[model samples]
Target: MMSTRLEPIQIGAPTGRLSDWVIAPMHFNGFAGLPTTRNESVKSPKFSCFGHQWRLLIYPGGDRESSDGCVALGLQNTTKESIEVETKFIIKHPHGGGDIRKGWDKVARLSPKGSAVVGDVGSARGYNNFALRSTLLDYLFDGALIVEVHMRTNKPGQQSAPFVPENPAFQNMLKDFGNEETADVKFEVGGTVESAKGRRKRAKTPTNTFYAHHYALRWNAPTLADMCKPGEVSPTTITNVRPEIFKHLLYYCYGGKIVEGDLQSDAKDIIEAADRFGIVSLKLEAEACYVDTVEVTLDNIVEIVTYADSKNLALLKEHCMDFLSSANKIEAAEKVSFDDIPSHLMKDLMVAFARREGEGSGNGDTLSSMRVSQLRKLAHEKGLSVDGSREMLIDAIKDDEEGGETES
Candidate 1:
């Protein structure tokens, strides 16, 4: 079992959009209120193209020492290995003005971030001074700044993967996921603390116990490998992870068999667990599963969007928001509770809705085609009626805005 390693994944054929460049456009509304202090950045939701997840990181007030007084922009590679991409950035002008286009873009290579937490920008690469803040602010018409990224992924260079002869005994070990007889390591996941011997103590529950081989975990997960190192005790206790999630993690660690469980309910948890275990490949796999499996409906849109935003699951959030902003669904979405949306996620939604308005029905200056909830929220803020049809609500908000302008 120790010598059983699989062959390199045969890249026989390209997946979706593998042969073409992907044009991703991002719009940030209410840019003035975003943090202006240096390196304080915001990220666009994850997007998938050419079989990889990606994002655009924006440091509104620059990133590093040399980047001060400018906005920094970077393209992040979310695959298991490092990637090089041919990339370009275009700052779009509002109200039919010419776009501020530049070919001068320096993108550093993006590598796999093993066990690095979020906000660690090591997995991304782009210009430190993507745009001068002083001048860049002028492009934010309607408090919105838009960027269009033209990128095509370069084919990964051929690399050698170790091919070891398979052992039947080792292959059989993988079949027994939690078999104590076969597994050399034990783990206790998710238990409560109790007052024992006049002090609080951590104890393991029997149902929560899981078993696995040390070498398999050590080889598959760098974080778990650290635990199996010298000076570490057995029956390792992990309070943060549930037993089911741990079992799933062990399943992937032993072999590469990801159980096609209920992904819609557990996908977020799986993605999170994989990240915690330094399983970059598993994280990517779980993310792809969630992105592909989850269906966002009006009833579930708010909850799904909030989760995606909180996790920075960009592509999932983007897809849900797209479904949410469709003309037929806008009013239906208002019936759901968005009050629970985090401030940051609410901002994302607002920005998305504003963009939809700009592209669909807005005059490029005045607000139009806002969702019913948005209109009611505005009406309430301005001490007006929150009742009526969408059109009536829009009219009331419009009339109030006109009245305020006349008074001013």
Candidate 2:
């Protein structure tokens, strides 16, 4: 019998043909003996963290956050291994022609695989709608290697502008996303990744080969102690990620192979890094942190937008809005100065209100300050039965006064 192996296809390069047909075949081979490890006897709770373990907070695109708080990871969705895991599609366009409601409804109906409805940016009022989950990005882009989506814009004909690669302001808007690239000035997808000590280096390989073998690869670990050497981890790579996060990322460098009994947080940071870099497998791992453990908090709300670019938390952002509104009603709310909060969260709040209030009429008609104040007065008359309403009304009044316009 003759052997047949297809030639390697390089993605993101201009010359190669985009893969038309790729498939994974199941095998019926007999099983081999399982090998045991020295640390196999010891086990810890899954996702547990302790001394020396590191995890990263990552953005969907796999970049670090600008605030120096969260780590970043880039993910690829096609390689996910779990049969039971849920996936979603997120779309973001800066210029803005797509109707948020219509677009989301279309995705739900049109998706080849029925996906559960996750939250979206347009779900809230003040959101840019251009911001979305990176997991959704892979799906919406649909393996195009490079995608250019049309946006809605105020400018006539500009309503359909492209979300170009050149439009990387969003990527650079955060420190972590911008920090991941090597400064060599050439952007090559899947190029070699070399650590200073020569302990870790990643090479370009085929997706087919990667998935076919069920094999996972990680770069070798290098420490700051070893980084000073001439061939050790590059200074550029070292500079992008935090030392602690990188220290944890070292585990992945060793082939996604963690010590059997290690805590989950140890991998959290690393998984975050992977998500920033578009390493799909890592994002899936990091998402485990929130499963059965999700909560609503203003801090976490800010963190989701600030660190992960995940707008899937529509409810959380709503809570933040309500909290801010309530606080403002009781006493003037501090002007929201952060670009991330005022720009994004406000949008979320508005959309949330509209969704609850009904769009364009009914409850929606009450989105204005006068309506909020009316609701507050009613709540006050009724002993503040509405959660956070009075404070929200107060904030509206304060804003009106500050703007030299009274809310009638």
Candidate 3:
């Protein structure tokens, strides 16, 4: 039996305005007896289109008793609210690579299945003529049938709204309670009002004291909340964190945006501080900023991966793994010291490398045992230099596998 590789297709997000339509491809395998007199349908994976989840329902045999011989397909709006959608269904021709039917386009009001009956094909008599079971079998690629559905919202003028309301009332509330006049708690960073940059100035640095309402700190940062008492007169001395980074964290707590540029150079420190203070949202934001701005290279991949592992940042670790496995594979293998990588992480990298080369087991015979022709074939497949002695070829292959450039 041949192994069927499931490759995910990349779908680009809509550019300017919200997407008017979404295109999703559904592949159905194990197509035996389908669509009998009973109402039966195969469902596609749920996808987000126009701010709502949707799926495709394909019926090989007619869905209803009236239309038993023909194929039936429908669009289902899985979301709770009623949605207006226009759908176009196209089936690939079994023989030639074109549309079997010209194309079927319909506009309807769609709601959850039980609530309202909408956006269905062949509801009247069922589409019996075009997609027969025998014809679909011929079109199957490796015993799988593929169908494409194009779905667009009927309300083209409506714009997608943000899930959270950006209200000014919360900012007003912060200002009222967070100012020095009303704030009962104080945070002093490094015994100075200014940050590291301010310390370099000729002028004397004053004590860095930020006033905040204890309630705000309690609500935003659970860890910090634990340290604070109801009416403590003495300021909380934070010796570990820099004044500027703490200011950024405070800003986020007060419903202010943390500009990406301000934290670009201090992402690691900020993320660590956020993690320590139990600021989940700020930690996530810092992680995203770090991933977006940091350059991934052979020299830094191991360090970054280790840092991510230490911080328990799953997304950053996954990003680093992806880069090391694909973009900087050869360089990482050659330059990164395996001693620095955790044992479990190294094992994961080995497994990934084997999977990329379609190797069942990572261990294998040396290049010397293989013939010159075989070595040449392997080099050609891997895009490596083939003009070399058996020993030289062996060294080159090993270096390439280890993500190192062959020596001149």
Candidate 4:
């Protein structure tokens, strides 16, 4: 049994969006007196997304730059004004298991079996906060970071709140970016807003107004807890293993950040950890490795076949069968092919057939010739008897059938 060596995979530029599922509420603690205020958001001045409620908020640079259960849509403006988004929404992340050949988008939607783990949750009130913070942050910060915005609703009369980029800091932040020219980036993508008097509300409104309660865009990178880690080792030791991979892992821990280059050997161990921890990108890298260089072993072959059988991975099972040709194990091959017997297994099955044939010949006196003929006929129909021997077996079976009829 040859040990399958997993090859190192080369990292490539991401083609699809990242997964950032909302798991918490995005709130501002120091908002004087609001129905939703958080102590954590005030002391350190950082907002969160989707934990108990779904939210989208601004990123205030700080040490504790990590949060659980919130999908991070990092600073991205691939197109003008529109921030690039990444998420692990229950309906989004590609659940390829360990298969690498599967495309990300193709695997994005969850099947019925996988739906429970990916259902939508969290609140829309927090969504309003996320939008406001993101728009305000976009106004204050350089183009360096984009705010996060949410798209799902967890309550009635609540939906994605658009960011208002026309506030005070909005101009100051634009000036810092050398845009000097003042412009308003409208926030309404879809849906309508009504005023307190039941009339239509415009984009600009008083802070005390319900429309002002809308959220801004905000995103964070992956954290230490999000990335792969060595077994029971301190984070410092992990950094020493490979500074770059460790840094990438740190970003993943904060949120998700994929650094390009050859992943270190220690990184491989961490990738394994990432798979266990539900880090999507790390699992993707591991799958790439399995596709690129992992050798198929007997145990792996069995696992692949079994899973393929269960999941209808016909191509994968076929590849496994081809790989097992040289092993020359009859029972194993039979299990994989369901007794169909690959050409490689043909010789083994043939030898067994010859032995059985010889035993039957020696026991000719134990059973009547008619019984043997009938057995040969059944074997011929199953392709178990020799080619062109069908006529002889049929003739014998016909004679036996006739003799039995006469006797009756």
Q: TM-scores, in order shown? A: 0.36, 0.23, 0.44, 0.19
What residue runs in model 3 are displaced by over 4 Å at the alpha carbon? 1-167, 192-205, 327-331, 347-408
Q: Candidate 3 residues 1-408, lDDT tens each?
A: 889887453232223423356778778877664445445777778888777777776777656642545667666677777665556666676667666543334444555534744445222212434476676777776677777777765444344445786778777865754488788788877653334333533224445788887777787887887877756988887866777778888877777787878878888878888888988768867887898888888878888888877776645765676577775656666898878877666544554455456666435664533544466578768887554344455677777887754343
Tens digits of per-residue lDDT for model 4 on 22-140?
Answer: 34222333332322223233222224332222223323321133342222222111111212223321211123332111111321221221123334321111221222332233232
Ranking by TM-score: 3, 1, 2, 4
Off by over 4 Å in 1: 1-185, 190-205, 213-215, 227-233, 262-265, 327-333, 336-339, 343-408
What TM-score quantifies how close candidate 4 is to the native fold?
Answer: 0.19
lDDT of 1 by residue, 65-183 (tens): 54557888887877776654557788876666777775423323456745253463457667877777777778886888888888765444333446777777656757776777766
Note the clash tally of each candidate: 3, 56, 5, 46
**Candidate 2 clash figure, as a count:** 56
**Residue runs of model 2 more than 4 Å from their true location after superposition:** 1-268, 284-304, 310-332, 335-345, 356-408
Which of the numbered candidates is closest to the native, going by highest TM-score? 3
> Candidate 1: lDDT of 163?
71
Give the Å error, residue 95, model 3: 43
In model 3, pairs of residues that clash are 70-128, 192-208, 193-207, 193-208, 330-403
For each candidate in the order shown, give its overall lDDT on alpha carbons: 0.67, 0.32, 0.66, 0.33
Greater lDDT among 3 and 4 belongs to 3
lDDT-wise, the better of 2 and 4 is 4
Order of all candidates by lDDT, from best down to worst? 1, 3, 4, 2
